[model samples]
Target: MDLRHFRYFVAVAEALSFARAARNLNMSQPPLSKRIADLETELGVRLFDRTSKKVNLTTAGEAFLPKARDAVRAFDAALRTARLLSPSHSRRLRIALPAETSRNVLSDIVSRLQQERVQVHLVEASTADQQDLLTAGEIDIGVIRLPVEKQGLWASASLGQPLGVVMAAEHPLATVAKLRLCDLDPYTLVIFQRRFAPGLYDEVLDLCRAGGYVPHRILHATRMTKALLRTESAVAIVAERLAKRSGEAGSKEFIWKPLEGSPLHWWSSVICRANECVGLTRVAVDVILASLQQHEGWVPMPRSVRAQSEDIRPIEQRVDSVNAH
Candidate 1:
């Protein structure tokens, strides 16, 4: 059958009532019944058991239901891809990111997309929540923190920066050239909540454990390092990029110093559903990688390689903006 048959079959299977399915499809019962019958005949099996009282899927119907839904979903995604590429249709890419993300990376990617005449709508979400949204198709793609479980999704670490500690400028540890994970054991540590970045959160804790220190007083929140360190003798582990953009760190108020021993690398990744069409999402992923490559610690992939399977044109111009988020 066609896509329409799959759509009709899904609606009927879900509703389990010809009258309800017809009404939901905005068609009459006879035509809807005929369509189901046609689909069953074409498939050489009955898809539903019908009687005067109720309608239910037979054994064969149960087996075919999932396949039919998959067909409809694929068809819908193809239509969405066509609509996205048309000049008449608005080319808006919906991207989700962690609440406390790098300012320069996001600004650079947005500037690049705007030059290509594409609009980006950004949503602030936790890394865990972004994964959920990506799987459900609520967002086009997401920038998530590393150490994430792929769960059969497509993801890669697109950008990385050295992780450091942010603390009050007057704190005793500020005089040191660099601080290690064990150095913060004396003060309360402020870190991102587990819900926001579970992988990163666990990594920080594990590092502390390895350093022979289990942080007893840890504050977990999604606030700026300045605010987090203001109330008490506390420190927050953050990316060097975020520390530089905070401005408070450079002033007399705060100080950011890299970790000693092996440095901790804060990584951000781009993720999308495994089966999603990559026409528009591919462009957004490239913009992220291109913008991040300018950073000191970012790893560059080969120019000839594509992150996604789709073939897309490269953005020719690089743009910069002063915005920070």
Candidate 2:
């Protein structure tokens, strides 16, 4: 028989009722019954035991049920691969890299994908915007800061990115060996808008309060530039990787000082739709992780933050055309 025979057999086997299976399959019982009979004839066995009152699987049906289920699953996976991706979007992964993420991290990821002959289209988004884009299927994956609301998504293990303070070199605190959060109590805090990372935003404030620094005023800016980053009246608490790119760091007019105790351990992760991640999508994720391994300022994600709902497969288990191109 063909896939249809297996499909019909599985439906009948799972329901254990010819009439119920036929109704669920949207067909009349006669054809469904005949198809099951034909399958039994082709296999040279009686696959089911039928009586007036109820239905049950015979020994042969019980033996064949698992095989039939596997066949159905394989067929559906193949169908999704062939039909779900539009022609224009095929093999071209649309990705969102948030503003806080280092551009070089993305560049390295693209380089790895190129080695495997996969193309990429990139957009700069905040972690918050990336969340919306991923839900809408407008993009396949995103590199964002955690903690994300974990529903309908799968995420890679996080890499910890340490945070530090950036201010003008002439600022009073710049001379200290290591700065504490509380030391900046006199100055305003220049930070990213809360919308960029809602969870991180609230977490940072709590951390400041815990550290004994509660700013009287906070300035929220969407983009961090040299003009805003190294202001004398405020200090920006950001990742050192990001601070170096603010255009003033190279001039030596801005200094980045590590926060004592490393209190702000920013976490980064790659996320994608749980149900839709497969084939090339998985390959892309593996490649991205491999690329991140080449950079600094990343450590393994803590066990506590990983979502319990999805299995985050080990890199070796994921399929990637690492050698085949």
Question: Which candidate achieves the best TM-score against the true structure?
Answer: 2
lDDT of 1: 0.70
RMSD after CA superposition, every candidate: 11.0, 14.6
lDDT of 2 by residue, 1-325 (tens): 8999998998899889998798757699999999999999999999999999888899999999999888876776566466456675566788888765566778887887777677799889878778767654568888777666645667766767788888887888878986898998988788888877887787778888889889898888746545665554578887776667765455578888888898887766777877666777778876776666556467664524233222233211223323322
TM-score of 2: 0.65
lDDT of the candidates, in the order given: 0.70, 0.74
Off by over 4 Å in 1: 1-90, 102-107, 224-228, 295-297, 300-325
**Tens digits of lDDT, candidate 1, 1-325:** 6788888898889889988788766699998888889989999999899999999999999999999888877876677568656785457778887665567767877888888777888888888778756654567778776656646466543355667788888888999886777777888888877867777677668767777657778887655546769887888877766776767567788888888865466666567766553556667776766655664346632221322221112221222331122
Question: Residue-pair clashes per candidate, as listed?
Answer: 0, 0
TM agreement with the true structure for every prediction: 0.62, 0.65
- When summed lDDT is taken over every stretch of 10 residues in candidate 2, the lowest stretch is 308-317
